[model samples]
Every structure is written in C-alpha cells, then in structure tokens.
Target: MSVNSQITRTRIMECASKEFMEYGYQSANMRRIAQAANVTTGAMYNHFSNKAVLFDALVQAPAEEMLDRFRGIHAQFKADLPKLTFVHMKETAYLGTDWMLEYIYAHFEAFRLIFCRSEGTRWVSYLEELIAVEERAYCDAFGKRGRRVEDMFLHIIAASGFQYLVECVSHDLSYEKAVAVLDSAKRFSMAGWQELFKL
Candidate 1:
C-alpha cells in the first residue's frame, strides 16, 4: 500500500476503535466511523469489508496472542506433570497471572473492547473460548495422571478460574490492584486444586 493508503487505513481503524468502544459492536455506525476518520464510506469499505472485519482487525491479534500464551503455559505444565508438585504448580500459576496481567495492561484497549464492547461480534464468546481451553487442559492433565474428574466439575473449575482473570479486565483494575487480587485468588484456587487433585 502507498503511504497515503496505509495512513488512511490506520485512521479508519483508530476511528473504528473509538466507535466500537463507545457504541459497542451491535450499535456502532459505520458511516459515523467513516466520518470520524475523514474518509468516505466507499473508502472505508475499500479498507475494511464490513464492520465485523474492521472490529476483528483491531482485536484479533491480541486475542489470539493471549490464548496462545495460555496454551503455552498449560503445555509446559503438562510436559512436567510427572514431577510437578503443589508448590511448583502454585508458583507457575502466580507467574502466569503476572504475565497475563502485564499483557492485558499492555493491550488494555483491545481487551476492554473484547470484554465490554464486543457483544455483536464473535469476540463476545472470547471468554467462553478461554474457559474451554482451560477445561480441555485440565481434562488432559488429569487423564494423563489416571485421575478421573467429572466434566461438569471441570467446567465449573475452569470457568471460575478464567472468570477471576476476566474480573480484572472487566473492572479495569489497576495493575497493582489486579495483581494483589489475582494473587489472593490464585492462592485460594491452588489450594482447592491441590486438595481435589491430591497433589
């Protein structure tokens, strides 16, 4: 793309971000976004096929990155499951929480859109997707250890664990405050997991 074209695309994305943040995906106006970007509707369409595409462009990368990071954390834990102890699990959980907090803060706007302003988009299911990933990880880990856990129970645990993380994002907690809250939550959750898993 030419410099001017690239600049216009960036401008459209910025304006679209503000529009989505303000009105949410269901109510955001494409024409208004175009106007805000100082581009014609046709030009905006040329850059982004539609409102959903535009919204995805803004958040897809960060969303995928977060999930990938979570998967990586679980993958590492699973790899070392044979030797993993309660203390190691607790320490890893804390480290993961800290990494997640730092990532969310760095991409606060993208996450805010996902958590708060993405009702009409597929991003609305992002939390559920995260929970599913957690659920799968737990199932795999327990199965590998020949430990049987009920699916419903695993779902509840996974949902609650991720919901605690989402609370930090939804409430817009400061980094320090979020860290403190998640630390306490992690301690509680690790104790529960340890008891349940007999680790």
Candidate 2:
C-alpha cells in the first residue's frame, strides 16, 4: 500500500463519484475527475486502467462491505434463527446503510452505479449466495407449512415495502410514521404469503 497510491486512489474516486452523480454514468468525465482530484490524467490512469474499471471498483467497494455484513448475519442466523426475525424488516440493519449513505448520498453516484442495469447482474451474482440462504428458508418454511410459492420470495423481499420503509425513515421520518406504514407493508405481505401456504 503505497501512500501515493492510497492518496491517488481516494482522490480519483472522490472526484469521480461526484462526476457520476452530477452527470450520470454515460456523461462522467475522466478529465473532470482528474481535474477535481488535482491529479494529472496520467495519475488517474495509473490507479485505474479505465473508467469502467474505476466504476467497477466504486460499485464493488460498498458491495463487498455489505456482503461482509450480510455474511456475518448469515453466520449468526445459521446458529440461531431468532436473529433472522431480529434483522428482518428492522431499521437496526441500516447501521451499515447509514454509514454507506455518508459516502453514497454524496450524489447517489455510487448507488446509481450499482443499481442501474449495468451493475444488476454483478449484484445478483454477488448476492446469490445470500439469496440462496433465504431461498433455503423459503423451502424449509414451505415444506413445513405446505406452501408452494418459493420462486419469488426473495424477489418480493427485495421489492417490498421494507426498502421503502428504510428509505423513508432515512429521510428523517419518525419510526412511528415509517413503521405505521412498514408494519402494514410487512403484515400484508407476510399475511398474503402465510395464507398462500397457511403458515
């Protein structure tokens, strides 16, 4: 870890993230990042081979951090199922999201980088391992309760109100306000699913 390398990498990413957020991916300029970072274009290239590679790193850094946290939960939950309910649909999980937003909400550059279609497949592939764990839960619960709809449980979890609840709460909405909605969101979905299999 060369100090020069560290400083250069940080500077480029800081500037580049702002560029992407302001102009979006297609319009982000390497020259702008170099200028903003106070580094020569050659210096920017020294750390990242290309814009695509830099974007990939930007997406992966937060992703890897989240994966590490999720993996930690997976390990703990494997040992104790209570932990799943503990984390599921809870604001406490956003400890990481809060930390991430510190860097990410700068312009949502990082968020857009990972969430836009360009990075979805990579994200799915990375989370497939975690998705597998939830899938197993679906299978187990379905088997125990005779529920047959296992195909999209993970998808529902991803699309459901939980995410909305979090985003809203992050915006300074009271937990009472958010949870008032989130509980309905959770119960309605949970009830529908439970009814689907009579859980």
Candidate 3:
C-alpha cells in the first residue's frame, strides 16, 4: 500500500474501533464507519473485505499475543513442577498477574472490544478459550504428578479464576485497584488449591 492508502486504512480502523465500541460488533455499521473515516464504502471494502475481517485486523494480534504469553507462563510452570513448592506457585501467580495486568492496560481498547463488544464475532469465545487453556495446563500438571482432579472441578476453578481477571478489564478498573483485587483473588485461589492438592 502507498502512503495515502496506508493512512486511509489506519483512519478506517480508528473509526471502526469507535463504531464497534459504541454499537458492538453485531450492530456496528460499515457505511457509518466509512463516513466517519471520510472514505467511501467501496474504499473501506478495498482495505477490509468485510466487517469480520476488519474486526479481526484490529484485535487478532493482541488477542493471540496474550494467549501465547499465557501459554508460555504455563509451560514454564510445568517445566519447573518437579521441584516447585506452594511458595513457588504463589510467587509465579502474583508475578504472572502483574505482567498480565500491565499488558492488558497497554492494549486496553483491544481487550475492551474483545470482552465487551465481541457479541457476534468469533472473538466472543475468547474468554472460554482462555479458560480452556488454563484448565488444560492444570490437567497436565496434575497428571504429571500422578494426581487426579475432577474435570468439572478443574473447569470451575479455571473459569472462575479467569473471570476474576476479566472483571478487571471489563469493569475498567484502575491499575492499582486491579492489582489489589487480583492480589486478593490470587491469595484466595492459592489457598484453595493448596488445600485441595496438598501442595
């Protein structure tokens, strides 16, 4: 794309972000986004084949990067599992929550869109997918230790743990407030896990 085309594309994405934020993905209008960006609908289409594609363009990178980072954390935790104690787990959880909060704030709008305005997009399932990733990691770690946790129990733990994290973003909590909330949540959860697993 030329300089002008790139500028137009960026403008379209900016306008589209506002539209999606206000009306959500299902009700967001492409023509209105085009008008806001000072482009014809045809010009917008030249840059984005459809609304889904445009939404994907805006959110895909940040969403995938968040998941990849989360996976990396779990991978490292599992690698250290043989010698990991409850203290290690607690420290890791706090450190991970700190990193995750900073990252979420850095990409606040992208996550806001995913959590609040993705009703009709494939991104709507993002929270469920995140929970599934957590659940799988727990299962793998427990299995490797010759321990067994009920699948339903694991799912509940994973889902509720992540929902707490999601609440921080969805409610637009301040960084300090979010950190405080997550710290309390991590302590609660770690206590529960320690009792259940005898870690």
Clashes of each: 0, 0, 0
lDDT tens readout by residue for model 3, 1-199? 8999999999999999999999999999999999999999999999999999999998999999999999899888888888876577678878887888889888988998998999999999998988887898788778867998899999999999878878988898998898899889988988888788788
Model 3: how far residue 114 lies from native, Å:
0.9
Residue pairs that clash (backbone atoms under 3 angstroms), model 2: none
lDDT (Cα, 0-100) at 54 in candidate 1: 96
In model 1, the worst 10-residue window by lDDT is 84-93
Residue 1 in candidate 2 has what lDDT? 73
Q: What are the Cα lDDT values of the candidates? A: 0.87, 0.58, 0.89
Tens-place lDDT per residue, model 1, 1-199, is 9999999999999999899988989999999999999999999999999999999999999999999988888888888877876576667768877888899889988998998999988999998988887788788778866889999999998898878767888788998888889888988988887787788
Error of 2 at 78 (Å): 5.7
Q: Report how far off residue 174 is in candidate 1 (Å).
A: 1.9
- Badly placed stretches (over 4 Å) of model 1 are 144-146, 195-198
Q: Pick the candidate with the highest lDDT.
A: 3
Q: Report the lDDT of model 2 for residue 174.
A: 52
Q: Between candidates 1 and 3, which one is better according to lDDT?
A: 3
Kindly provide the TM-score of model 3 when superposed on the true structure, using C-alpha atoms: 0.92
Tens digit of lDDT per residue, candidate 2, span 32-138? 89999999999889888887787777777766766576656545544554334433523433443343334444434444555442432344354354456555544
Q: Is candidate 2 or candidate 3 better by TM-score?
A: 3
Model 1: how far residue 154 lies from native, Å: 1.4
Give stretches of model 2 more than 4 Å off: 1-5, 71-112, 116-133, 150-184
Query: Highest TM-score among the candidates is held by which one?
Result: 3
